[model samples]
Target: MPNAIRRYVRFIDRTNEIVGLIMMYMIFLMIGILLYSSIMKTVAIPPLWTLEMAQFVMVTYYMVGGGWALKNDAHVRMDLIYANWQPRTKALIDTVTVLFLIFYLCLLLYGGFSSTSYALKYGETSYSAWSPYMAPVKIIMCFGIALTLLQAVAQLFKDIAIARGEEIS
Candidate 1:
């Protein structure tokens, strides 16, 4: 691989790793919100925003962490035959299969950006009691999707190198 491509992969991997690590702490935030809600319910009227806010946090967690999951190979797979493959064989298969993932991610990112733009332009809000503005979460979703897409491309490059019997660190 060229130095530029190697740098690109490293940059994407590092960026996603940092973001994913930071986002991992959000689980604690969600837990705190739920705990507050539960305590409030026992003592007084529970805040209407607690549950919805926690949901938003959860969305941020998974969506933003997606790239890191891919980089770390944390995503689930049907390893029936894949698990038995040799390293180069596995890389060859991944080089082909990752194209499908890239295609799907591209479509998802397109829709995510479109929805985010609509939410921003129309000042959309969730149809709930708390009714929070939707743009922030929508934007986050798009950003996350974009990160995942970039990571997918990086993975494709890495797989190509591996398939060609050229290891890329």
Candidate 2:
């Protein structure tokens, strides 16, 4: 890989690493919030926003965490078959799948961004009693999808390089 492309890849990888760390810590935060909510409920002082807040946080965690998972190659797959493939064959299969994923994620990103824009334009909010504005969450969802798409593109490049016997690292 050229220095510039390699640098861009490194930057993306590092950014996703930070995102993954945030997601990891958010897991702890979610657990703490839920536990506190449960304890408070036992004492008859249940927080009305606890469930809704948890849902938002959990969704954000999953959204932003997805790209990190892909970066680490942690997403589940049919390893029984994949592990038996040759290197070029593996690259080919990954190329096909990543192309499909890129298309799907592009659509998702468009939808997410459009919904977020609409929510902001119209002041959309959750119907729950807490009634948090939907725009922020939608924006975050879009950001996550964008990151996932970026990672998918980077992976596609690498897969292509491998298939062509070109050096990537």
Candidate 3:
């Protein structure tokens, strides 16, 4: 790999690691929050803020972690057909899949940006008592999508190289 690509991939890898930890933490936090809410029913009505916050974190983490999943080939898939293909044929199929993802991510980026802009312009807020700044969450999602799209382009190149009988790195 070129130095620049390698550098960026390292950065992406770090981002993925940090975000994965954050996601795991969020899951634990949610569980704790739910238990607390259940226990405190008589004390108070708990809070809806946790729900909205969890939703935002989930979206952000998914987008940011998507590229890392692709790099590790860790995404869940129905791999029965893929497992049967020859190596070279698998590379071809993988290339085709990458192309499809590229197109799909384009749509995602566009939609994400539009939604972010709308949320920012309208000062959108979650239907919770503590209506935090939701625009930051919207923008983070868009940023995450952009990160995945960048990695997709890199993966497309890597796949092309592999298909052409060249090592990816």
Question: How well does candidate 3 match the true structure in TM-score terms?
Answer: 0.80
Write down the TM-score of every candidate.
0.98, 0.94, 0.80
Model 2 pairs in collision: none
Residue 6 of model 1: what lDDT?
Answer: 95
lDDT (tens digit, per residue) of candidate 1 on 1-169: 9999999999999999999999999999999999999999999999999999999999999999999999999999999999999999999999999999999999999899899889999999999999999999999998899999999999999999998889777
Please count the clashing residue pairs in each candidate, in the order shown. Answer: 0, 0, 0
Candidate 2 residue runs with Cα over 4 Å from true position: none
Q: Comparing 1 and 2 by lDDT, which wins?
A: 1
Best by TM-score: 1
Model 3 alpha-carbon drift over 4 Å, by segment: 1-18, 127-132
List model 3 lDDT by residue over 1-169, tens digit each: 5677656656765666566556556566656655676766768876766566667766665766676677677888898888988767778888899899989999988988888788888998876788887789878877777777777777776676677776554
* lDDT, ranked from best to worst: 1, 2, 3
The sequence of per-residue lDDT tens digits that candidate 2 reaches over residues 1-169 is 6777777677888889888888889888888889989999999889888998888889889999988999899898879989999899999999999999999999999899889999999999999888889998898899889999988888887888788887565
